[model samples]
Target: MNVDELILVSIDDHVVEPADMFKNHLPANLADQAPHVETDASGVDRWIYQGRVTGVSGLNAVVTWPPEEWAKDPAGFAEMRPAVYDIHDRVRDMDRNGILASMCFPTFAGFSAGHLNHFKDPLTVIMIQAYNDWHIDEWAGTYPGRFIPLALLPTWDPQLMVAEIRRVAAKGCRAVTMPELPHLEGLPSYHDITYWGPVFAALSETGLVMCLHIGTGFGALKLAPDAPIDNLIILA
Candidate 1:
């Protein structure tokens, strides 16, 4: 093949995340507490995780809507693209756009289960594993090479985190979404290699990459402490 004909790859792609992701993957005993799809009192469809509302509504599906509407306003499933959650539809869109592969990070699950930190432990850990299972088995396993499965683990305890990393590493996950600014999120600093030695070692042995997306630890960009998100987004 000619160099000009090389396939384009999107290393930082993301998933809108279907509402039933955790529900379908979690154990029956814990499934009810998992995230689920529900329409808010305002009639907006959203993913409710442990009773907390999450995600950017239809932001991930903007391409499926009229350029004028979704770019500014929140939208529901009906108003957005089915391809955002459906793997088959996503592949078609990638084909149309000439993308051969994508490494999709999580939406509501945070940059790499960072959102799970807001909840309590134990169950929080379970949910992270659930999301990883769903990502690997259903997402990547379903479509093969079209998408890369990015897993997230419980990062509160270094020991448990290492174990979880090894567990997923054995499952063929090539990359794991991580928090770049852990200290900002009330966790240890990235310089604390003493606690992170095991993490790096496992990743090195398994050949897994630490993929950190923006806003995983905290706000990625905030021009003003109290400024409106709009100002920061536009100005930044």
Candidate 2:
């Protein structure tokens, strides 16, 4: 194929977050400990039901698409249809589009780290662990070179944060994204915290790239009443 005929890849696209049933595939004991594994007000039990993460509080509930449909076409109706957190389908879609490779981000995982009021340190650590494992084992593992998994770290806990980074890197993840907002109490930005120095050094050493995507937890911006929303949009 000519250069123009070659497909281009879009790294940094999103896959849906796990639903309440995400733990269903886990061992009974371990799955029981998974958060948000309950029924919703409508009494649905499945994880991807109605595109919401039931049994959990916070913003980790948005659904992208179902796994079956996603397996059929990933980029086609991502905006119009629901999506599953399946990485295999994502790779298939890339292949169908003639894309060579792509990087994937967690849709609901990033939202959890972004919302300050909903996610506490312990919960953040747990969810991050579950999400990372799912990404590496379920997503990247199946696709190998075709997919690059972006690790989600708990910015709230420095020690666990660094350890998680190391663990994911050992599993072949080379990029991680933390919310631009401070997910923990008392710390300013991730750059301002002294404890994060070790984490940063480790990342630099391992050639891991730390990405900051804007989210809700970054703290509130004080906008003057006279300022136009356009300015805020532009800054964003």
Candidate 3:
């Protein structure tokens, strides 16, 4: 069959979270603590949460750039494609590439958001829910069936994880990203069935799928700490 006849639906696409993601989603009291984008002296935009920088604005959103250009990080959101975060532009880009639909994973705080566990704050659960709301209410909801809603769970607690599963499922999210290796994120490993039993049951009850995205729990591949970022991207 000709390439033009192909109907592709990408199950592993990603979105570079917008600067004002938490603006409408979070409660007023928590608004001050919500993650926001900040530009460093170098001009690279990074997501800052609770006074700490989480992830860069354009970590892997350089798909359309030339190979030689991929080695360099996007100076800021202005340098990245609007499709990387804008729902309408994303659909247009999909059409240009002959993609029917896409299930996008998180990139703002990372795939599973396990980094939030480092904070040990009760507000982490609220943040996860707010992110899911933005993903379901704004991102995928804007385009209806053109985009698939995937959520990030509060993996630090099994009870919270189950609650988030049911909550996002109620918002029309079909899948939630799970840390591929939960133990690495300070959670009980998959081998500990007792700890994860409720989480599994919640997914089964909500009819939501669990997506184990690689590198969410760990790096794509182990390499020296001094390895170049471009090498990690290419090899992974």
The residue-by-residue lDDT of candidate 3 on 1-236, one tens digit each, is: 79788989999898988898889998798898887888889877878778877656455687777766664344478888899988889999999999999999887677788655566667877888888899999999998998889988877778888878887888788988888887777778888989999999999999988988776533444678765667656654
Q: Of models 1 and 2, which has the larger TM-score?
A: 1
How close to the true structure is residue 14 of candidate 1, measured as C-alpha lDDT?
A: 70
Between candidates 1 and 2, the lDDT winner:
1
The lDDT ranking, best first, is 3, 1, 2
Q: Compare the candidates by TM-score and give the number of the best one.
A: 3
- Candidate that beats the other on TM-score, 1 or 3, i.e. the better one: 3
Residue 52, model 1: Cα distance from true site in angstroms? 2.4
lDDT of 2 by residue, 1-236 (tens): 58767877667566665454246335565554454434446544323222334222122222343433222112212243232344555566667668887766565344334432145556446656667777777766677777677887776667777888898898888888765556344455666648678778878877788876554532476667665434544665
Among all candidates shown, the one with the greatest lDDT: 3
- Summarize candidate 1's per-residue lDDT along 89-192 as a digit string, tens digits: 88988898888999997776777676676785788888888888888989888888888778897877787778778888888888888887887677777799
